[model samples]
Target: MNVSQTMETEEDFLTRLHIKLYHPQQSCKGLYGMLPLGKRSSHPADVPLRLGRDAQACTYALVDPRVSRKQLALHAYRTAQSPDMLFTIQNLSQRGRLSVNSSALGYLERMDLPDKALLRFGEYEMLITRESGEAMGSFEVEFEVLEMPPSRETCMCVPSVTPVMELRALVPLENDETLCHL
Candidate 1:
């Protein structure tokens, strides 16, 4: 189901955000088991942030709420396998309009705004701002559904034997090279 259908109120919106941030399984089908943390920007000048695994190389530019009238951009970097994708969700709360523009994908024009705005594309997660607050409100912004690589292992075997037989095997052998013959 689309987020609009499932999410109706501020509380529901917050709950969905929590689930998308913390519990992946309950949010979407393909994203349930994927990595949720990624490398975050460390520049002191940048807004303090935390990232999920799926957000590698993604950059978020926060417009000062005081300066800008109403717009935010999430500058996301694409991986080598996939072209750079910028998934933008514009929310004009005063006019009550929301739109999504993606670089890899086409545009989702002028979707009517409900109460909040959320956009999810592949591993990318984004939530646009609607109102200012004392403490910055956070939302899971990027998610990448990556298939974990397979792992390998090695094994060795030892036989069960009586202590006497084992002692006999351990005795000094005529030829050192023949010690493994037992």
Candidate 2:
């Protein structure tokens, strides 16, 4: 197939990426909500997603005072490295700290995310998972064949060696040439 066709195949396998913010069931007095990133609910997937305690960030509004106005930002898009969507996160909080699976993120630092990455901001924590149709589809197509070189020598001929004296007693050889003396 042509270059465009190859890319189109890869695109079809990629799913749209999004973040899922799951509130601890007991943290909000049993009144909890999960926020999925998208534009329909004012959560723009293409733009930097603003998250924090500010009521203005209705897309991902957190009521906890410990969360800064803009604690974290997420940007999602299709990446050329893999057939699955990738995401990058930016720490926007001044006092709050951000971490992915226990790895701390510095202020304003951006880092690519992996599947099922756990994010923590102050007292809140969320899990990031795929949100598109392809995420649930068969993953067999995502793998590419990798060509590797042979690991050992490939000689086919049997090595030549002198016949032992014990063998000569059982079956006599007329000449050393017949024994493949080389």
Candidate 1, lDDT over the whole model: 0.29
State residue 179's C-alpha deviation in candidate 1, in Å: 79
Q: Candidate 1, clashing residue pairs?
A: 36-52, 36-53, 37-52, 37-53, 38-52, 38-53, 123-143, 125-141, 125-142
| Worst-scoring 10-residue span by lDDT in model 1 | 149-158
Clashing pairs in 2: 38-43
Residue 84 displacement in candidate 2 (angstroms): 3.6
Report the number of clashing residue pairs per model: 9, 1
Tens digits of per-residue lDDT for model 2 on 1-182?
77876565533544544444444433454123333324323223456666666657633665565568878877766656655545688888777788876679988998887765667676455555554434423221111111211110111011225356644464434543112222
* Best prediction by TM-score: 2
- Which stretches in model 2 have alpha-carbon errors above 4 Å? 1-44, 81-83, 131-182
Q: Write the per-residue lDDT of candidate 1 for residues 56-161, one digit (tens) a residue.
A: 3223322122212332233222236632222223332333232232222233233332223334332233433232111212223333332320000000011234
Q: In candidate 2, what residue range of length 10 has the lowest lDDT sum? A: 148-157
Superposition TM-score, candidate 2 onto the true structure: 0.52
- Alpha-carbon runs more than 4 Å astray in model 1: 1-45, 48-55, 59-115, 118-133, 136-182
